[model samples]
Target: MSSTQKPVSSEDALGQKYDRCLADLLVKSGVGFGAGVVASVILFRRKTWPIALSTGFGAGAAYADCDRSFNPARIPGTRILPKAEAPASK
Candidate 1:
């Protein structure tokens, strides 16, 4: 590494992390759009592209934002801990 090269800071890394999140949002939104279209056609028995597109985009975007904000680590764990067992009587 050259002395002139600067070390990557957390701020710099955050941008790339957000970029990945945005990509994920876009891809998931696309999938949701398709799903919504199919659902509309199946349930409504007609072309409801507008509703489908809006619903899909809204749901996907909301989900992505919420997921990112609330569960950045994506760890599988419960907020509440298990209660300890009581002592057995003789």
Candidate 2:
């Protein structure tokens, strides 16, 4: 006989998906910051404040884009889970 397991609830699925997206955003932001700092240093060495400022703005824009794209629903309390309210055993 064939058997099929029930799929996860929508809430649980969405929570997992959002967690992954948040992690990806954080990693990307770190990379973006590092790239921005390197570019800014190069511009500074060239004695160009305008270029450095523009690079910084670009980095900010990238971060903003990630924030808005991944955080559309604004999941509340997704970042922290209290220890007292732990799930009980059946």
Candidate 3:
């Protein structure tokens, strides 16, 4: 190992994923809310359903991304490495 290289454990990797998921959730939901508000005001005549629908859509997308992050199999066209060739997370 080099002096500048730091070993990362599975726990650390999990934590990083969680942090990224949280950030994505917040950003996606916020953008959805903004879009919903704009649509509600201009197109829907201030209806509340558009706001909720848009926000839910954004949150759903974020959730899907978080799912893929934790479970690589959820991603399409990806094959699992053979156990012998896979790196040990520990």
lDDT per residue for candidate 2 within 29-68, as digits (tens), equals 5666566567667755644554546555655665565565
TM-score of 2: 0.44
Cα distance off (Å), candidate 2, residue 86: 43
Model 2 weakest 10-residue run by lDDT: 72-81
Instruction: Tell me the tens digit of each residue's lDDT in model 1 across 1-90.
Output: 666977899887778777777776777777777777777777767667855685668667756675755565654563533466655559
Show the colliding residue pairs in model 2. Answer: none
Return the TM-score for each candidate structure.
0.49, 0.44, 0.85
- List runs of model 1 lying over 4 Å from the truth: 1-7, 47-90
lDDT of 3 at 49: 94
Superposition error at 90 for model 1 (Å):
43
Please name the candidate that would achieve the greatest lDDT relative to the true structure: 3
Clashes of 3: 0
For all candidates in order, the CA lDDT equals 0.68, 0.63, 0.95
What ranking of all candidate models by lDDT puts the best one first?
3, 1, 2
